[model samples]
Target: MDQFEVMSELYSDRSNWVDVRRYPSTVTCRRMLRLADFAAADPARWGSCRMAFEVPELSYRELAVARGVSHTTIMRHLAKAEVGDAGDFTARELDGECPEWLRAVSIRFEAGCTSRTYRYAVALCTFAAAQPERWRVLRLAYECPELSQEELAEVAGVSQPTVCRYLQPVRLEVDESFNDLEVIY
Candidate 1:
């Protein structure tokens, strides 16, 4: 859940305080103190729209990258925030469904590696999807006709079988590493 959603839920309850954008400057200090007191008493209301308190102008990418979190995570925050007619937030899904080429490798990885998840694989795919340039580097050997298995594995950050899956044209194969995720291809 985005932190804002958490805030909104908290603010749903009643809070008592003057909504003072109209208070007299002669007593601005008093109103400010009262406002502070009100906020302290109802942290949830303050949290729900914390962004509104500051410059309050964060683009989607800026918000995600600044926080070092996924864009999807940011969207969840915004969606839950439900800020003024703000758009929608849908999480991308990348789970299970191993490529046909890795079937064999999936088996091999099982023998000596720890368990991993399709979610993990999809996370990698999500990373790749989010950053296209990175994909070019990872998939470099696919265009090279003379590279050997070790060379492909080195570039792919995975085992030879994992590379072999990439080498195949029709379907991605798995050996045994479905659980380990140690192999990177």
Candidate 2:
């Protein structure tokens, strides 16, 4: 289960609330806890939102009254908290159009071999940096070997064709490697 589910289960009982500090230091838990404590919004309200509906003690109306808005506004805030913020994860800087190390590797590899593996590598790296969604699909494929391409696409919120296209470089590299080997038999 994800860290949020674990947090929900932990907070299901009032007795365990005191032990929240001992929750696993996974990304979700760390981000929620940090946001609850340090967000520009009121800490108690953020705590309620972070805990979400999992902790039944804080009512939406109560929060709405505190904020001087309708309960729907409070509900929306809670929903936003549950969804988490996109900026929570650090954005990747372009650093450079192409990293120097990758460029050097591509040059050396191309010089050493007839295969276009290095060329594909450079292309794939550039493609991934330029298109993060494709990179996410590729990453999901690597992280979940048991998952099929369609499943990976589903998990990455992309289409199966897109996943296949993004993975073409890796497939090409593997096929080329096999073709390069001599037939001993």
Leading candidate by TM-score: 2
lDDT of 2 by residue, 1-185 (tens): 22233233223212212266643334444443333222223434444443343334557887677567788767666653342343443121134553324322211112223222222322343344345565666566766889998898888788888888988764322223313422232
Q: Which candidate has the highest lDDT of all?
A: 2
Q: Poorest 10 consecutive residues of model 1 by lDDT?
A: 84-93
lDDT of 1 by residue, 1-185 (tens): 23233222222212212355432232222222233233343343333224332224667677667666677765654443222112322121123353323322311112233223222222333333343333433446645757787986776577877666645543323324335324433
lDDT accuracy of residue 119 in candidate 1: 22
What is each predicted model's overall lDDT from 0 to 1?
Answer: 0.38, 0.44
**How well does candidate 1 match the true structure in TM-score terms?**
0.22
